[model samples]
Target chain A: MSSFLPDILALFFLFSLIIRRLGVNLAFQPATYQLLTYVLLLTIGLKGGQALTSEFTFSLISNSLIVIALGVVLTLVAMLIIHTFSAMNQSDRVTLAAHYGSVSVGTFAVALSYLQLKGVSYEAALNLYVALLELPSILVGLWWLNRNQSSTSLKTIFGHQSLMLLLIGLVIGGLYGDIAEPMVKQLQPLFAVMLALYLIHMGAVAGSKFGEFGSNQLFLICFAIFMPLLAAAIGLGTALLLGLSIGGTTLLMTLAASASYIAVPAVFEQAQPNANVAQALVASLAVTFSFNVIWGIPLYHHIAGVVA
Target chain B: MTLVFSFLTLLMLLAVTLVAQSTGMVVTNYFMLIAALVVYVGWKSRKSVKVSLLKRGRSAA
Candidate 1:
């Protein structure tokens, strides 16, 4: 319990409320989110790439497929659950399913920090996984939303900043040998600070939607809390099958359970405007984001200890 | 955001699969399981999407 940093997640959330209470959108200026998210993605990629100096392999590719598949399975199941629960209408459920199924990079970052504390050596290649995992859910959602229509558009999917920055990091990291340590030293230290900036911006996003929480259907609140646990269960199974070390298992478990508050929303805006964006946004941002940070991280760690 | 989350999921797949193949750490289970999940889920829910669309149609009309 003491290991948890309630203040970090809470602080950004609080900052959001304060700014909202003051009646200003200070964070949106100069597209701070774009810059900050890319930096976070690039640095994470570089650090991760440095970790994987051995360069490409079948296991890395196949495991990534599995992770992506895991995401798809989760998203599809989450959509089913949301619909079955009558959580919201079709539009909202589809959008929300995408959110639930996708991985939260911020949460992953925090989990990585936690793993470092435990002295766990995580796969640097997982950095690429982090970026790549952002896609399948969005594509799944867009496919659902636009199945009736034509042109879901490959450019729309690949053109995203998150995916691109992540690739650049991986490429740079994969190509460079031994220099990763210095790069990691310079970049990784700033992770906490970068995360703070990202969270503050997210807080503003959450803050923007503060009034929108629990307005019509509040069942997603339950979904939000339950998702991490569900993800952990599946992740634990995956970890066991992968034969990952305890720390690796824990990190994988954490990632599996985590929810996306960043990339999925952008896809919704870009491709599926008719889908209920606000419901999905509020549910993920306000509910899962904080839940994972404050309680879910520790909860998943405990689950990992028990299961892994 | 939900879609973007999935997007992240896909990107990670691209990164890891390439590396794992090189390092000889490529586990076939991941490939088999992901394929199975997709195929199974698609089979089970094949009709659900159409049903929902019909429902939406009824509601909309």
Candidate 2:
């Protein structure tokens, strides 16, 4: 399993970029991208829910709350840094905060894939942490953005497509338990395949956006790379405090290091229409996502190994 | 309509996975199948890839 897959992933990404450079558009449909992402999200939810069948506990609740709080803290800190360094307006700064604060599912998937490849075992239901960590920063961002006015209803936020699909998959897997074992096992083997496809799309997209790198100011680009490193440090500290294993520590570091490309933009598009969503996407997707996939995941693992 | 299709697809995929499992297909086979599928796609897209390689080579020359 480990022999050729990782090498193929990196090769596919570089190949995508090379293909693009040759003026071959590779015109994959929009729906194909959506379907790929949805499959990945559902698979994560299903696996986490299946694990939760036996592992769910009160301690899980405590850990989830801590993780959620970590999201809030990360967002607020992002808001501070962007406020100080970025000359962008208030809404833009808040939007950047939301992006930085929320976790990236693509990054989380890669981290999981990395652990599996290395035969590292983590806490079984860490996907619960992923789902829990998605929301708080978004809510905080909205609240800060619209402090003077009424914010988007929680119903609207919860109804976002990615979160809903994840929650639905989690509920289904949790409810079915061992009855879903065959399906879960089936889905498990397909994860790396699904993720590789997702990353290829991500790489193609990022490759196309490489031109946009220079359009962003120096501070934004610096923030994009450095923020994840700093966030990983914070994540590592929290994981140690929680007495998590090396795998758990690494995953937490990744969740901290990743910035949202999916949920934040969708929500911000609806709520803060005037906000600079494009800037946030360029930073998160083009800069942070690539960094995490290529380098940050392994680095976080090494740091986690050393520290925790 | 999109949401409905997504849900249906999920269900269908789950059923297929179960059926595949019950048929005694092992996990490694599934992995190999996906690996091959990826390779097939790459093969299909080889024209663009070749063009890109030639462009790079010509530029270097």
Candidate 3:
């Protein structure tokens, strides 16, 4: 898990860049991308379910709650940091904040694979923790951004496609468990193939956009790179103080460190279209996503080894 | 059949880790060197590409 993460991440980062560069018009190829995303989600759900069945103790649930709380708090702190640094307006700040607050599914998937490889077992409830942590911080960030204005509706805020899929995936996975074994068997191979293809496409997209890393993008990219480490440090310290295991500490740190590209971006597009999608997308997809995959996991593992 | 896939995935993951572990410092150095190479290539290519695009636009104008 530890060793393969860097390579897997690097591959994904390159894949995303290549896909972007292909200029194949993602909008027209919605089904392909959508299936790719679903497969990823389904993989996450199944793995999470399996993990949950293994480690569903009272303490695990309690710790998951703690992790969720910490995730939200850390997200707010990251938002505050972004606001302080960038001269972004309130709406843009809120949009960015919501983004940094929510976890990236891609990053989480990589982290999960990393952990599994390293032989580190975490609580299955953490899947729910991952799902639960996505929406609230978004709400909080949006509410904070719009508190001055009275026109925004909650329905409008929560009505995001990625968010809907996440919630539905979680519910279906949790309720069905492995009882959906027939379904799992039917879907697993298809999902696996789709995941690999999506990843390949992602690599192509990211590789093509590698040229877009200009001076302005540099600052945003640097923020994504370093912020995860800083957040992980804070999370690790907090997790230790709260008395979590080594695995728990690592997962918590990961959750804190990850930035959402999926749910947050979709929401921002609808809610705050004025926010720089190009900037956010470049930062999240090109900078942060790549860094987390290649370097961040190893750094976290090294840190966890030192501390734990 | 499902188990076979799972086993294969696990094996692939294991292979990845084993290679990284064996190479360790060499792998890290390789990554850093490759990253530098990619950046340079990307920058050089981008400059020419941007220049060409600008020239084309000016000609049209």
Candidate 4:
């Protein structure tokens, strides 16, 4: 067993207790939630910027594009599975599909950290791919959900807050990356404060949403846990077929395994308010988030080693 | 307070840019700090909001 496994488990238990004792409402304030989102965005942009500073080769770009394509395909498969097994309404299934399709930045971050700790080298430019893979699944998921429903509109679905912020951030990161020096130096401190503020808010959000988990939510929780594993397995297979390194394979697998809390939930709230945000949030944040962070990262790494 | 948050956010952005330009510290300190702060403030706000809601419910009862 990896040395970090025990630490992850301990952290999970500790966070759960703290969240349960404090209550969810106390953990997830609206302002804090907004701040957390911003922080995540900034982190992603910075990572992309740093990665962009390095040399970009054709092979790296090609591999990234392939990984992204595989991500979308795996997301579709996950959505199909959810649709097949669960009793969720069409809209809910679609929303859930979008989430499964999208990448989880937190999960990706954790995986990146894990790989670095393991002394594994990977293409930092993959961060750009992570950002790229986020949006298409959302569009596809929304399209699938609204296919039969008259209530859905292209404008409303495309013009979501999460989508807009993510796109703007990605664009800025890409543009600024080409510049010789950092263009947003003035805003760095503000972004830092916002990022810290955002994570705390996310903790609160996760805590409050914890209450939303009950017997009624068990099926979805189970689905969330298993579906990622299944998707990761497929992603791993695809990576091997593409001859990606173990580190690259693990990163792709992690991306597949992670679900969207930031982008999907935001879009769902605006597009389908009645789709039970608490249920989605609780399942994604409380159950799956904890599982992936505490156990999945190390577990997947071990598995990838055996396979490789 | 909002001003503080805004000011802090600006400082964070600058710090991140400097760090990014310098060494390859994969972990973004500013982001982690921001996340921690947001969670703390969020928890506090949530508590106050819940208290207000509970008090209103009691009065109605």
lDDT of each: 0.68, 0.77, 0.63, 0.63
Summarize candidate 2's per-residue lDDT along B1-61 as a digit string, tens digits: 2223223323433443354456543334334433443453345346556888999999999
Report the lDDT of model 2 for residue A102: 95
TM-score head-to-head 2 vs 3, winner: 2
- Model 1, A66-168: lDDT tens digits are 8888888888988886776553678788888888888888778777766665566766666776776688888888888777889677877778677777888
Using TM-score, give the best candidate's number. 2
lDDT of 3 by residue, B6-61 (tens): 23323433343345456443245335633553464456557757998999999999
TM-score of chain A of each: 0.87, 0.94, 0.81, 0.78
Off-target runs (Cα >4 Å) in candidate 4 are A1-19, A22-29, A59-65, A148-203, B1-61
User: What digit string (tens of lDDT, one per residue) describes model 3 on residues A1-308?
Assistant: 44333455456555455556776422226687787787777666765665566556677667666766766786687677666566566665566566667787767766766775678876566566677767766778767766777756677767766556666666666667777667767766575455456656655655555577554443465456556666777778866866666666677677777888777777767666677655666666666667667766666665565577
Total clashes, candidate 3? 24
DockQ in order: 0.02, 0.02, 0.03, 0.02
Q: Poorest 10 consecutive residues of model 3 chain A by lDDT?
A: A1-10
Q: Looking at model 2 chain A, which ten-residue stretch has the lowest summed lDDT? A: A1-10
Which of the two, 1 or 4, has more DockQ?
1
Task: List the candidates ranked by lDDT, beginning with the highest.
Answer: 2, 1, 3, 4
What RMSD, rounded to one decimal, does every model reach? 12.2, 14.3, 10.3, 14.1
Q: Let me know the TM-score candidate 2 reaches against the reference structure.
A: 0.79
Error of 4 at A29 (Å): 4.4
**Interface RMSD for candidates 1 onward, in order:** 13.4, 18.4, 17.0, 16.9
lDDT of 4 by residue, A1-308 (tens): 34323333225434644765565333445665666666656655665655565655677667767767776786688677766666677767677777777878766766765675568976555667677677777767666766777665666656655546655665666566646235455444455454334434455556666667654354565566666677778878876866767787788778777888877787778777777666666777765666576556665665666566
lDDT of prediction 3: 0.63
Q: Clash number for model 4? A: 42
lDDT of 1: 0.68
